[model samples]
Structure formats: C-alpha cells, structure tokens
Target chain A: MQELGSFLEVLISGLLAGVLYSLVALGFVLIFKASGVFNFAQGAMVLLAGLALVRALDFLTRLGFPGWLAIMLGFVFAALVMALCAFLVQRYVLGPLINQNALTMFMATIGATFVIEGVAQFVFGSEVYPLRLFPTDAWIAAEATFPGGILINKLDVWGGVIAGLLVIALALFFQYTKTGRALRAVADDHAAAQSVGIPIDWIWFVVWLVAGLVALVAAAIWGTKLGVQFSITFLALKALPVLIIGGFTSVPGAIIGGLIVGAGEKVAEVYLGPFIGGGIEYWFAYVLALAVLMVRPQGLYGEKIIERI
Target chain B: MGQFKTSYAKDMVIFPIRQDRIGVYLLLGFALVLLPLMMAFHVPPFRTDYFLLAILLPFLILSLAAIGVNILVGYCGQISLGSGAFMAIGAYMAYKFGTGISEIGLPPLPIVFAILLGGLSAAFFGVLFGLPSLRIKGLYLAVATLAAQFFFDWVFLRVKWFTNYAPSGSVSAPELKFFGYLVATPVEKYMVALIFVIVFALIAKNLVRGNIGRQWMAIRDMDIAAELMGIRPLVAKLSAFAVSSFIIGVAGALWAFLRLGTWEPLAFDINRSLELLFMVIIGGLGSILGSFLGAAFILIVPIFLTVLPAELGIPITTGTVSHLQNVIFGGMICCILIKEPLGFARLWQIGKEKLRMWPFPY
Candidate 1:
C-alpha cells in the first residue's frame, strides 16, 4: 500500500511537471508554425520574462503600491515588454534575414537567447527570487488512507488549474480569431498564403508576440513553483524532447509528450534507479523518446510526406 | 613574373602557388614538431601551457567534431544536435577499452585503436539517427538529432557497463603514452592533438574536395535534383554521418585523453553539443578553414574577455565576467551574421580580395 501511494504521488507530480513542459513547447510551436524558424531563445525568454515580472512587482512595491496591485501591474507591464521585444525581433533581426537559409536564422535565435540571458542578468542580478503567483493561504486538505500517508502541496494543484485554463484560452484564440486563421494558412504553405495577399510579415510578428506571452505565462507558474533562478533556462531544454515526441506541428502532441516524459522520468527514477546508481533517470525520458522516434520519425501527428527525386 | 607564366599544370596544382604550399608545409611541420618542443621547455605553472592543453585540446576536439558536422550540416544541408553525444560515445568507449586493455597489461596503442573503434561505434549510432533524414526535413531532422544527443547522454550515464561499474558513475582515461613518451604531460598531449587535428583536417579537406564531397554538396544544394541526377540520398547522407561520426569520435577520444583526463557525463552534455554546433554555425558552414576560425573565435574570445578585463584592473566578478562573456560572444555572432551571413570564412575571403589591391585603391 505504501509503494502504491508513492507511485501515485510520483505520477501526479509528473503530470503537473508535464503541464509546464507543454507550456514551453507551445511557445516553440507558435513561432515555428508562423516563421518556420525554431526560436532557440524560447527557454531564455522564459527566464527573462519571469525575472522582469518579479522586478516590476518589486519596483511597484518600492514606489509604495499595494502588494496585490503591484503584482497585477507587473503582469501587465511584463506582457507589454514581451510584445515590444517580439516586434523588435521581427522588424530588425528576423525581417532582414527573411531571405536567408534556416541554419542562419536558427543561429540568430541562439544569439538572441545568449543576449537576452545576459541582459536579464545585468538588469536583475543573478539571484534566485521567490515568486508569489497566488496567496500562500490558499490550501485544500484531502486525506487518503494507505499503508503510509503522503503529503501534497496545495499550490501544485493551483498551478495545474491555471495552466489548464491558459492552455484552453490559447487553443480558443488560435482556433477562432482571424489572425489565428491567417497564421494557420501561413503555416500550411507560406508562398501560397502570400499569393493570396495575406500579410505574412505581420502574421509572423503577431505569432511571435503570442509565443512571448505564452512564455510569460509558463514562466510565472514555473517561477513561483521552483523559485526564479538563472539556471531555470536549462529547464527549457526539457521542452525540446517533448517537442520531438509530440510532433513539432501539433499542439496536442506537446501535451501528450509532456505527460509521457514527465511521468516517464519520475517512474524511472523511482523504480529503476537502484539498478544503475539512480540520478541518470533525469535523462531517461530522452532515451525513451529516441526509441519512440525510431518508430515514428514524423512524430505522432506530424505530416507524412514521402519525398521523391 | 615567371610564376604567372606557369602552365595549366601549375594552375591545376593542389597548392597552386609554391609560396602557399611552403607555408602550409611549414605550418604543419611546426604544429607536429615545434609545439612539443616548446611545451617541454615551458613550465610556467598556471599559465600558457595549461591553457593550451587543458582548454585548447577540447576546443580542438570540438573543432574536429564541428568540421565533421559542417560536412553534413553546412555542406550537405542536414542539421544535427547530436555531435556531443557521439563524442561521449568515443570518450566512454576509449575509457572502457583503455581500462580493459590495461587490466591485461596491454600498451596504449591498443587503447588508441580502441578510441577510433569507439568513434566507429558512434558512427553506427549516427547512421541510425541519420535514417530519419530520409523522411524528415530541416527542423525535423535537427530535432531527431537532438533526440540522439539526449539518448546517448542518458545511456552512457545510466549503464554501469559503460562506466566499468564505477561507484561514482563517472569515467576517467587511463594514463596514455605513445612509444614510451608520457602523453600525460601538457606538451606531449598538445602535440598529439595538434598532429591528429592536422591529419584529420587534411583528410576532411580532401573528402570535401573529392567526388564524395561533391555528392554531399549536391544533396545539400538541392536534394531533389541530386536524386534525379542519380545520387542516392541514403548513401550520401549515411556516408556523411559515418565520416562525421568518425572525426567527432576521434576528437572525443582526444578530449578524454587530453582535456578533462577525468570527467563525468556532463562534460559532453547538451550544452557542450550546442556550443560546438554554434561554433560551426557562427564560424561558417561548408568551409574547412572556417572550422579552425570558428573554434578560435568561440574559444579565444572568452579567454580574452576573462583576461582583458583583469589586465585593465576592472576586477569583474566571475559571475559577471561569465555573463558578460556570454553577451559579448553572442553579440559578436549576431554582428558577424548581420554583416556577412556567409560567416568568417567569407569575411576572410573578402579581406584577401581587398589585400590584393591594398597598395592603391582600385
């Protein structure tokens, strides 16, 4: 009974972790679909956004604003800053390089990631800051009878709820809006969409803006959960494996990949760890996906096109 | 100019010009012989020799790997994120082989052979990963390679057999030597690396200029046309992977033998892989000279940043220094890309062109 309870706890923690991973993957998918460039900076963007949000809140408090109002103001101001970053990236960095190859564009994104991480460090010193996403008193106590009891954090539950709502909101925005429709059209075929007079440039910019917002939302939740640190950017590397398993183009794949990798790593660590000295289970998720990739190269939902000479 | 009156035979020469060939020969001879002598004479503790062997050996290893990758990525148009993992395979394989042989009282030559063999094993993995390139395009292929990186890193770290069932879960190279010359010394180690790099780089240059290289370039420029032109995509890609893996594996062995001498799996972690890939990308793809230039830029700039600030009495904190280094390094990449997206090689070519007309404005 104790073993069963521990397994259940591991599984639940993995699912919550998966939700955050999915959020980061979603940012990659948005920019990839619109611009066809993998935003290598997405991970760093998460770190920068979270740091900015914390700074905004702190700045407001220093100016004598109430705590709650300060927090709210921080959220809005951070979003605006992210949007501006998107616009500048598209206008100056990406727009000029539109004629360049994918490798060049990818290198540019890497450059962006390094530059952002540095600027963030400069702006907000390299210190881990705790983020208060919600009230500390918001707790729900539930007890389950087993051989031994397990303790679960109430805040983890809130993180799940907020992440779910955010995912749904994003899904609706992408599915319903005119911008979303155009974005999909461009993703499907850039040249054909351009021939039909869609403003390809603006679509890329807006989609990148949306990706930044997605990053902001993920960062806030994750930052609050883990505490904000410069090393948090490495966590974003976790999303790449998810992206690979989920299929680069599918939103549903991100969610599924997240759950599989998250739960997979936890279970492996708990069950198979003693066999090989343990901590390597952190990388086991990726090994599992590699096997999966050998079977399904285009990913689960990615388009299957056989190239002919 | 009797040299200018040279026949088509002279024009078609591999070195084309005599002075250039002499320069190349002199440079190679110096690297192979002179570097070892210099290292033997010098013993400034915590100074140049240590920097050259400790840091530069790994950078050279990464450069060789990047060159291998450049053949596939820059020249052949396939993107990969798995170079570091392939390197890990070489490192671990060398460790396993060296230790296994030493247990039987075998010499270091067998270990050297084992490291190359280790690289061949990584090439096998590369082919397995490259199989996806037959179906996927661009970013998809890159992601597939990234999966390989993660998988190999996990397996090597987790599997006890790879680490010789070590308690610490980390592996180290056995003390290596060549012809009874202790290779553990910085000078000896640097010469070993210098020799290997020059030889492999020449081989890579030859491969790129040969028929196989042309076939890879054909595939890169336009796969459909290459396919139509009777080139098999599978053969071209897999061969590129094999060659790339072989070079990367050798570099990985050198990294183990020379650089860390002792390291955990994280030494060849994803960050290292990305850094190497960036070295190739920022340096220039598809150019042999770019491999060296990129390695120099990526490796030397950070050192320069670290020392230059201190020399000026800035007294920058290590954290701030590293952060600033990251920013400046990244910014320089952006600036280089923006100014000449073709990379540093092209910039060098442009400089050469300008130099020919240097005395008076054209």
Candidate 2:
C-alpha cells in the first residue's frame, strides 16, 4: 500500500511537471511549424520574458499596486518586450536569410540565443528573482484511499490549469481566426501561401509574436515554480526531448509528450535511480526520445515528411 | 606564371601557385623553428610561457577538433551535437588504456597507442550514434545527437569504474613519455600538440581532396541524388562519421593528455560541442585553412577582449567579461552569417585574389 501510494504521488507530480515542459515545447513548435526554423533561441526568449515580467511585477508591487493589478501590468510589459523581440528577430535577423538552408538558420538562432541571453541578463541583473505568483504549498486530496493522502502540489495544479487554458485558446485561435488560418497556410507550404497573396514576412512576424507570448505564459508558471534564474535556459534541454516525442507541429502532441516524459523520468528516478547513479532524468528523457525517433522519426502526431530529389 | 599548369598533375598539386607554396613553407618554418627560438631567446611576447600554455595549446587542440567537425558538418552536411560525447569517449578510453585495470593483469599501454585507441573507440561510437542519420534529417538529426551527448555525460560522471575508483572524480593524465623522452616542459607539451595537429591536418586535407571526400560532398549536397548517382548514402555518411570522430577523438585525447593535466567530465559538455561547431561555421566549413582560422578567432579574440579592457584600465567584473564575450561573439556570428555565409576563409581567399589582380581591373 505504501509503495503504491508513493508511486501514485510520483505519477501525479510527473504529469503536472510534464505540462510545464509542454509549455516550453509549445513555443518551439509554433516557430518551427511556421518558419521552418529550429529556433535555438527559444530558451533565451523564455528567460527574457520571465525577467521582464518578474522585474516589472516586483516594481509595480513595490509601488503599492494591488497584487492582481501588478500581475496584469507585468504581463502587459512582458508582452510588449516580446513583441519588440519578435519584430527585430523576424524582421532583421531572420528577414535577410530567408531562403538559406536549415543548418544556417539554426546556427543563426544559436547566435540569437547568446544575444538574447546577454541582453536579458544585462538589463535585469543575473541574480535569481523569486516569484510568488502561484501558491507553493501542497494539498492532500485522497486521505481515505491511501495510507498517506497523495501529496499534490498546489503550484503544479495552477500551472496545469493555466497551460490547459492556453492550449484551448491557441487551438481556438488557429481554428477560427483569419490570421491563424494564414499562419497555417504558410506553415503548410510557404511558397504556395505567398503565391496566394499571404504576406510571408508579416505572417512570420505574427507567428513569432505568438510564440513569444506563449513563452511569457511559460515564464510565469516556471518563474513561480523555480524562481526565475539563468538556469531557466536549461528548460530548452528538457523541451527538446518533448519536441521529439510529440511531433514538432502538434499542440496536443506537446502536452501528451510532456506528460509521458514527466511521468517516465519521475518513475525511473524513483525506481531505477539507485542502481544506476541518480539524476537520470535528463538523459533518461533524451534516451526515451531517441527510442521514439528510431520507431517514428516524424513523432507521434507530426505530418509524414515526403522527400523528393 | 598563371599559365604554368599545363597538365592534370600540375592542376592537382596542393599549392598550385608557386607563390602560395613559398608562403606556406615560410609559415611552417616560422611555427616549427622561429617561434621556439624566439621563446628561447626571450622575445617580448614570447617571454612568458603563458602564450604557449594558455593560448597556443588550446588553439591547436581546438583547431584539430574543428577540423574533425568540418569534415562531418562542413563537407558532409551532417550536423552533430555529440562531438563532446566523442571527445569524452576519447579522453576516458585513452585514460582507461593508459592506465590498465589490475584485475585483468593488463599492463598499461604506451601513451601513443592509448591515444590512437581512444580515437578508434570514439570513431566506433560515432558510427553507432550516426545510425539515426539514415532515418532522420536536418534539425531532427541534430537534436537526436543530444542523446549521445547526455548519455555519455552521465556515463563518465556516474560510472565509478571509468575513473579507476579514484577518490576524487577528476582524472589526471599519465606521464607523456614517447619512447622514453618525457614531455616535462611546457614547450615539449606544445611541441607534441603542434606535431599531432600538423600531421592530422595534412591527413584531413588530403582525405577531403580524395575520392572518398568527393563522395561525402556528394551526399552532403543531396543524398537522394547522390544515391541515385551511385554514391551509397550509408557508406558515405558512416565513413564521414568515422573519420570525423577519429580526428575529434585524437584532439580529445591530446586535450586530456596535454592541455588539462587534471580534469573532470564536466570539461567536455554541450558548451564544448557548441564551441567546436562555432569554429566550423565561423572559420570555413569545408576548407582546412578555415578550421585553423576559426579556432584561432574563437580563442584569440577573447584574450584580446579581456586584455583590451584591463589595458584601458577599466575594472570589469569577470561575469561581465564573460557575458560581454558572449554578446560580441554572438553578434559577430549573426553578422557573418547574414553578410558572408562562407566565413573568414572566404574573406581570406577574396583578399588574395584581389591582391593578385591589384592596380588593374576590368
């Protein structure tokens, strides 16, 4: 009973953690889908967004604004920052090198990553800033069913709820909005979309802006959970595996993939950790992703890639 | 003088121009004979051993690894984030061979042999991880290589057996005795690396100019077309992986043996892999000269940056220095990619061409 109870606790936490990973992976998917770019700077964007928001939130609250008002104002400031970043990146950095090969663009993003990281840290000091947006305490929901009630983190539940809502909103935007339709068309076939009178550059800017906003959402949850720091960039490492598991183009795939990775790594760390030196979560997620790649290179939900000479 | 190449043999010569050959000879002479003599005579810049130990040694070793990366990425068009893993394999494997396990009654191998063996092991792992390339392409392949990176990182860090049960996790290089001549001095150590780099670089240059090199380039250009045109993708890709890893492994072995006397697994992480990739891109992808150029630029520029600030009497914190380096390098990479995708090597070629045609133009 004790073993099962502990396993249940690990499983729930893993699923919740998976949502956070999905949030980061979601940003990668949006850019990759629209621009055909493997944006290495996505991690840096998250850090930037988190920094912009947290610093703003801190300032606004210190000025004696109400808690809710300060949070909303922080979101607005971060969104503006992200919008500026998108315009510059999509307009300047990615604008000129439009038709270059994937490899070149990828390298450029890595370069962009350094620039973003430098600017973000330079503007907002490199010290860790605590964000108490979400409650960090836990709730035990099932005392009668198990020996010890399953320890559920209140923060994880809030993060999960926020992520779910964002996904629903993004799906609606994609399915219903004209701009979203244009974004999909561009993603499906860039030349065709452009031929059909879509503004290729403008659409790319929009996609990036949306990705940046998604990153803001991720920053909020992740910031509150871990206290925003440079270490947040490491989230890119975690998100890459999720990107592999969930197809790079699928929103639901990101969520499910995150869940699988979260649960899988948590279970492995708890059970298989002692035998093989612990901290297996990082590589364990990657190895799992590698296995999935072997079986299905396009991932669980990615469209099948057809090649022609 | 430009019309002297009358035959195929003349055209195929490594340095087709007489002036180029003379220039290369002069450069080699300086590196081999003049540089050391200058240090011995206590020249201003060469007065301190810091130039030899800190800058030149790392530059040479990194150039060797960059050459390896250039072979795979620049020439063959296969992106790998696992060079760090291959380097780790080379380092750990060399250490394992250099200091044999007592339980197996195996005497420690010669340092040269151990280094070669380490390179061979890295090449083997390279081929293994490279299997995914057959199925995936582009970004997928790049991300997939991270599996190797993370896995090897864990193995070296956690596996107690690899460290020879040393109380401290860090492993120290054994004595670098080449047939009983101990490389005890910093100059001797530099000499070993310089020789290793020159030999391997020449070999890499020759290999890339050969038939196999053409095949790798063909696959890189378009695998399907190359396959239809009779260059086997499997063989070409795998051979690229093997050769690239072999060179990188040697660099890793040399790095462990020469540069870092005492080191830990953390030394060869993802950042190291990224740095090697940076050398390949910022230097020149397919050009041998580009690898050396890129390695020097990545390494030497930071020193200049650090020195310039202090020389100006600006008291800068170390963290700011590092962050500044990142911003400058990152900005340079972007600017280079946007304006001149071919990199510094291309710039070098353009300058030489212009110089050849100076004082006149069409």
Candidate 3:
C-alpha cells in the first residue's frame, strides 16, 4: 500500500511537471515549424527570461512597487526583449543564410547560443538567482486521509490550466485567423505559400515573436518551481528529449511527449532507482525516447513517409 | 629511373617510392623508441617544469575524444552532444573495474583489461544512443543524443552502486604497471597514453580509407542517394556509432586512469562533450590529422592563454583568466568556423598543395 501510494504521488507530480515541460517544448516546436532552424539557444532564452524576472523583482523591492505590478513589468520586459532577439536573428542571421541547408543554420544557432551564454554570464554574474511568485499559499492540500494522502501544489495546477488554455487559443488562432492560415500555409511549404501571395517573411517574424513570448511564460513558471538559476538552461534541455518522444513538428506531440517524459522520469527515480542504484530518472526519459525512436523513427504523432523521395 | 618507378611492384609498396619508405621507417622508428629516450635524457630545466601532468594529460585525452567525435560528426555526419556522457561511462566503468578487481586480488592484467572492457561498455551505450540517427537529423538528432549525455551523467553521479557505495562518491585507480614496469610517473603515463592514441589513430585512419569509410561518407553526403546506391543506412550508421564510441571509450579510460587518477562523475560533464565537438569542428571533420590539430589547438591554446598572461608578470586573477578564456574560446571558434568551415585540415591541405608547387608561380 505504501509503494502504491508513492507510485500514485509520483504519477501525479510527473503529470504536473509534464505540463510545464510541454510549455517549453511548445516554444521549440513553434520555432521549428515556422523556420526549420533548430534553435540551440532555446535553453539560453529560458535563462534570459528567468534572469529578467529576478532583476525585475529586485528593482521592484528597491522602488517600493506592488508585487503584481512588478511581476507584470517583468513579463513585459522579457517578452519585449525576446521579440527583439527574434527580429535580430531573422534579419541578420537567418536572412543571409536563408538558402543554406539545415546543417549551416544549426551551426549559426550554436553560435547564437555562445553569444547568449557569454553575454548573459558577463552581464549577470555566474550565480543562481531566486525568483518568488505571488500567492505562496495557493497550494491545494489533500484533506481526505487514505493512508498518507498526496497534496498537489496549486501553482502547478494553475500552470497546467494556463498552458492548456494557451494551447487551445493557439489551436483556435491557427484554425480561424488569416495570419494563422498564412502561417500554416508557410509551414506547409514556403515556395507554395509564396506563390499564393502569403507574406512568408512577416509570418516567420510573427511565429518567432509568439514562440519567444511562450518561452517567457515557461521561464517564469519554471523559475517559481525550481528557483531561477543558470542551470535552468539545462532544464530547458529537458525539452529536447520531450521533442524526440513527441514529433519535432507536432504541437500535440510536444505536450504528450513532455507529460510522458516528466511522469516517466519521476516514477523511475522513485521506483526502479533502488535496483540500479537510483537516479535512472535523469536519463530514463531520453532512453525511453531512444527506445521509441528505434521502434518508430517518425515519433508518436509524426507522419510516416516512405524514404524513396 | 622513371620506368623503374612506374613498375606496379614498386608503385604498390606501402611506402611506395624509395625516399618515402625510408622517411616513413625513420619517423616510426623515432616515435616508437627515440622520442622516449630524448624526453628522458635531453630535457631542459624550463621544459622539464613545463611537462606538468595537468597540461599533458588533458591534451592527450581531449585529442582522443576529438578523434572519436570526428568519426561521427566529421565522417558519419551524426551530430551528438553526448560524447562527454560516453567518456563518463568509461571513467566510472574503469574505476569500478579497477577497484573491484584489485580489492579481490585478481592480478593487474585483468584489471588493465577491465579498463578496455569499460570502454567497450561505453561503445555499447553509444550504439544504443546512436540508433535514433536512423530517423532524426540535424538539431532534433542533437537534442536526442543530449538525452544520453544527461542520463549517463545522472546515473554515474547519483547512483551509489556504480561508485561501489563509496562514502565520498569518488573513485581512484590503483597503481598500474605493465610487465613489471611501474607506470606511476607522469612521463611513463604519457608514454602509455601516447602508445594507445597512436595505435587507435592508425586504425581510425585505415578504417576511414576503407569500404566502411566510403559508406559513411556516402550516407553523410546523401542518405537517399546512398540507399539507392545499395548502401545500408542501418549498417553504416551503427558501425560509425560503434567505432566512434570505441575510440571515445578508450579516451575516457586514459582520462580517469592517467589524468584524474581519482575523479567523480562531474569530470565527464556536458561541457567536456561540447569541448570535444568543438575540437572536431575546428579540426576539420573528415581529416584524421585534423583531429590532432583541432585537439591541440583547443587544449593547448587555453593553457597558452592562461600561462602567457602570468609568465610575463601580468598578474591576472584566476577568475579574470577564466572569463577571458571563455570570451577568447568563443571568439576563436566563430572566427575559425567562419574563415575555414572545412577546419584546420583544409589549411593543412592547402599548405601541402602549395609545398608541391614551391618554386613556380603557377
């Protein structure tokens, strides 16, 4: 019964953690879907957002600003800065290398990662920063006692609801709006979309802007969970395994994959850990993704194509 | 003389022309025996102090790791950020085997063999991780491989059994010797490492020149084209993973046994993997000699940066040195990649081609 209780608790936490992971992976998927450039700087972007939040909070405390206003200002600053980064990348790096293959673009992104890391470390000293979200008492306590009942955190629940709603809103936007239609058209095939008079460049710009905004939100929630730190970049790396298990280009796949990895890692750590001397949780997600990849190269939701093209 | 040189028998020789054969034999003979003798006998006082273990071991191990990476990224066109994880696997496995055998008094040969076996185990894991390459490409594949890196690091760091439930969570290598000659000294360790690196490098060079190498190149150039050309993607890709991992595994062993002699899991972290990848990229991906140049540049340049600043009485703090190191390292990689995306090997090739036409303007 104790083991069963622990397993349930692990499963619950895993799913909740998965929701946050989905948000991060969504940022990756959106960018990849619009522009085939794999943004190696995604992790750095998360760090940037978390750092921005901390800086904003510190300033608010000094200036005697309200908690809510400070938080709002931090989000605004993060979103604006990320959007600006997207614009710069699109204009300078991606524009010149528009005709280059995926490999070249990937290299360019790696360069971007170095620049971000170097600049960030130089500006903000290489130390962990703590970020506090408003409403600390928002956690949900399990009142019913059935052999050491699990109490789920309200912050996680709020994060899940917000993430789900955002995903739905995005789905709706893609389904209905003209810009969304154009974005979809571009994603399908740039040349084909261009021939039909869809402004490919504008669509690409907007996609990146939205993706950056998503990253900002992800950064905030994760910062609240684990405290903002430079190592948060590695946490963002958690999304890559999520991407592998989920299809690279599929939004739903990202969400589902994140949940599976989050839940899987947590449960493995709690259970099978003792057998292998524990901490299999760290790598279990990737190994699971690898196993899945071996079985189905296209991933869970990825389309299967015959390779003779 | 032209007719004699043109004979198939003379042309087909391993050293081909007479002068080439003589030069080859002379170089090998020196490297095998003469280099050791020279280092032992003719070392200046300043140079003797310069031969610090920290400086030499990182160079040797980093070069080996870079070669391992070059096989995958350079030859096979597989991008992996998990080479460090494989190294960790090797180190921990070696540590585990090294201690386990010695604790039970199972002789030194078996213990030494255990280190090689540790490397083989890492190779096994490498192939396991490399399987995803069959589907993913470019960045997705990079992310996928990264999972392997994180997993292995976590396993080795957090798992107690792997560390033999040691209280401090670090492992050490016992005194190693070969044929009753103690290899406890820095110079002796350097010689052992040099021997293994040379042997593996030769095997890597020969492998790259063979049918397997051709298949890897074909897959790299165009997987579809290669598949149409009757090359099996699975076979070619997996073999690349296997061989690459094998090389990396050995490097990991050297790192633990010789360099650290005692280390924890953090010794083979993600940063090291990135460093190895950078070595391959800066070294020229497809060239065997490029691996050495890249490794030397990456490993040696930092030491030069750190030392040259201090040697001239320029008193730079350690923190400042580290920060400057990052900035310079980042800037150099960008510059090198931008100037010669083909890497240092291409530069070597250009120089060689120029040497062939030394006196003529044409």
Winning model by DockQ: 2
Give the TM-score of chain A in candidate 1: 0.93
lDDT of model 1, residue A179:
90
lDDT of 2 by residue, A220-304 (tens): 8899999999999989889999999999888899999999999999999999998888989869999999899999998999888
TM-score-based ranking: 2, 1, 3
Better-scoring candidate (DockQ), 2 or 3 = 2
DockQ of each: 0.51, 0.77, 0.35
Per-model CA lDDT versus the true structure: 0.79, 0.91, 0.78
DockQ-based CAPRI category assigned to the predicted complex of candidate 2? medium
Native-referenced Cα lDDT, model 3: 0.78
The A-chain TM-scores of all the candidates are: 0.93, 0.98, 0.93
Models ranked on lDDT: 2, 1, 3
TM-score of each: 0.89, 0.98, 0.87
Q: Candidate 2 — which residues are off by over 4 angstroms?
A: none
For candidate 1, lDDT tens digit of each residue in A1-309?
777777787888778778778889889888877777888889888988898898888889999999889988999988987887788778767887875767678878888888889887887778998988764343322345655455455666676687778778878988999998899999887889999999988998899889988889888888888888887897677887788788778888888888888888888888888877677555676666666666886677666646554
True contacts kept of each: 0.53, 0.66, 0.36
Q: Which ten residues in a row are the worst by lDDT in model 2 chain A?
A: A118-127
